[model samples]
Target: MKTSESLLAELARSGKPIGVGVIGLGAHGSWAERSHLPALRAVPGYELTALSTSSKQSAERSGQVHGVSRTFGTAAELAACDEVHLVVVAVKVPHHRELVRTALNAGKSVLCEWPLGNGLAEAEDMARQAQSSAVPTAVGLQARSHPALAYARHLVADGYVGEVLSATVVGSGGAWGATVGPRDHYVLDAANGATLLTIPFGHALDGLASVLGEPEELRIRTASRRTSAVDSESGRHVPMTAEDQVVASGRLPGGAVACFHYRGGMSRGTNFRWEINGTEGDLVLTAPIGHPQLSPLALEGGRGTSTGLAPLTVPEHYVRVPELDPRADAPAYAVAHAYQQFLRDLREGTSAVPDFAHGAARHRSISAGADRLAEGGRIVGP
Candidate 1:
């Protein structure tokens, strides 16, 4: 196996594509088709060398669609293949720990979607494995990759927000978790319930921190206003072990107290907005909803009733985000970009954002909020 730096340098010098294998051909996997595969092809230094799925049908279908030559029935085969230099795990949450372990154990670079694991324990284990193996790894916290959020971070860091008074973020939508259909229905089940908080709020909260810096302490409340009725195909009422709605309060690392509201049970129009108030002025970002796939970005700041300005322009680090078919939003492309950066880091051996350790930290932050909320909203540190 090549060291990350050496691999990154080679990718830089070769000016060609890095061979990659994609594991898990479910909804996220399909995303790999529409987003990752195409983005890899377009990104200049990456290649989709192989594909894998648990069943032959999926492998065959995706292989035909993407023009992939080598296909594997399992991740182990994909990771062990000498033809692939990077392993992308877009599988279900329950399988993340194992698949990541397999790829790293095989001395291959790996990238897995967020929450790292279903809970804190799994995330910790994954972190430990990454540490022991010294393999380049990345998690799917894509919001930080956006230019709007980067501008927000710059403002906050520059004290333009003026000592960070408070921040409130609201993310509520019905169809937010898993899309209705045969596509990865397992995610809605309690066993697959990792998506509950981690999927929706995890991405949002990660963005929250990126804009506001780390949180010194936090408290969270999780409630199941409605139970998930199993889709007839799954044959069981997947207990909603995950919190359908969560509200959290905490202090930012800069000493700013913050309140957050997240709900996965919205049956009507969606509501996604975030506002931060500092001593001197306030900032509000609305629309573009929270999905990163949609590009451009709407920006508004400065005190007292100012309508948001369009094309406010963002930092260079903020990606313009490629367009996806379903037209999900910027978060979608932002996430894919994050994954691509991981691939770049692995192939080129450069340090990427939100590595396993960063992912583990975010997991701890959420876990801390959950635990504290259990105790009547007392502040707790992770």
Candidate 2:
């Protein structure tokens, strides 16, 4: 088997845009259409060559709508296509394992969305497959690629905070509220693997880990405040088993305390706020709502005896991809940066972007924490 280095070198030497095939291109209001399509368009070195949907008719229709000629009804068909150099799994969480495996088995690179699998086992299995395939892989944890967050991470590392002491985060889920949409009802079921804990809280935690290091000795508590929600469109009641509130507190490396609290639904004030306090300084990140991976974030900091926090502008160099507004609230902004990083990794044979292995590690951490929570215990990290 060719090593990852050799495969990247081969792709670099080809001097052609990578042909990408995306699975589960729904008709409308799909993430693929909203974020992935626009992101792919914004970044160079990639071509949307093929796409697949649940049926041949829908696939052809989406192909025409997206201006792609090659469409398939099955992921296997798209993965086998000679024109497809990269296979993107953009479907629901439950379908990730099957589609990702199909692409990996066909010896194609893959870019799977976050919450990489239904749970830890599936994520580990996919990670093992990607390792054996020796191909480039990426998971959609775009919050780490956000320019503001990236700059904040650098600031923390550059001693702007002067030895981290503690961090606190509070955010709203934006879903799991008193009402559910027809398209989003699936997330209400804990079995569906898109619960508040796994989506909004999970993304925010990952972004926090990227900056403050992973939380250790974690104590977690979850509650479902709203047992049922009314369907906004149909006036029908839907049972919600997923936890609507999650709280976790722990210590980061270097003995800094970390605490997170996420609740279901939006708040009239302070929908998202994160503050990192240190011996000599403090940094704060905020957004209109939670899901830092999707929303734009603002950074503020005060260091060395400053009276109050002030907005800190991210330098232009942090916006690795040009021609895109980093401050836009659109989902495509951070996604475009992620795609640029992935392209750079492929060309330079670097693993800058989070891959399947990274996703699996995150899954393991979450799963372990959840298990301990179930046993009414705290998780002690390695």
Give the candidate number with the greatest lDDT. 2
Q: What is the TM-score of each candidate against the true structure?
A: 0.83, 0.94
Q: What are the per-model numbers of colliding residue pairs?
A: 18, 0
Candidate 1 similarity to native, TM-score = 0.83
lDDT of 1 by residue, 1-382 (tens): 5674366447646775667888864433465655566556645566778889887677877787668878877888888898777788876788889899899888887778776987888898999989888766778776776667778788778876677789998866333332223564555565663655777677778888778877677887776554444444655444343455678888887577888777764434545678888777777776534433233346678743554433355655555334432234332556556655655555555664688888888898887777423424321110
lDDT of 2 by residue, 156-266 (tens): 999999999999999999778877788888898999798888888889888999998989987777876777778889988888878878898888999999988898888
* Candidate 1 steric clashes: 18
Which residue ranges in model 2 land beyond 4 Å of their true spot? 1-9, 12-15, 327-329, 371-382
Local accuracy by lDDT, each model: 0.68, 0.86
Where does candidate 2 have its weakest 10-residue lDDT segment? 373-382
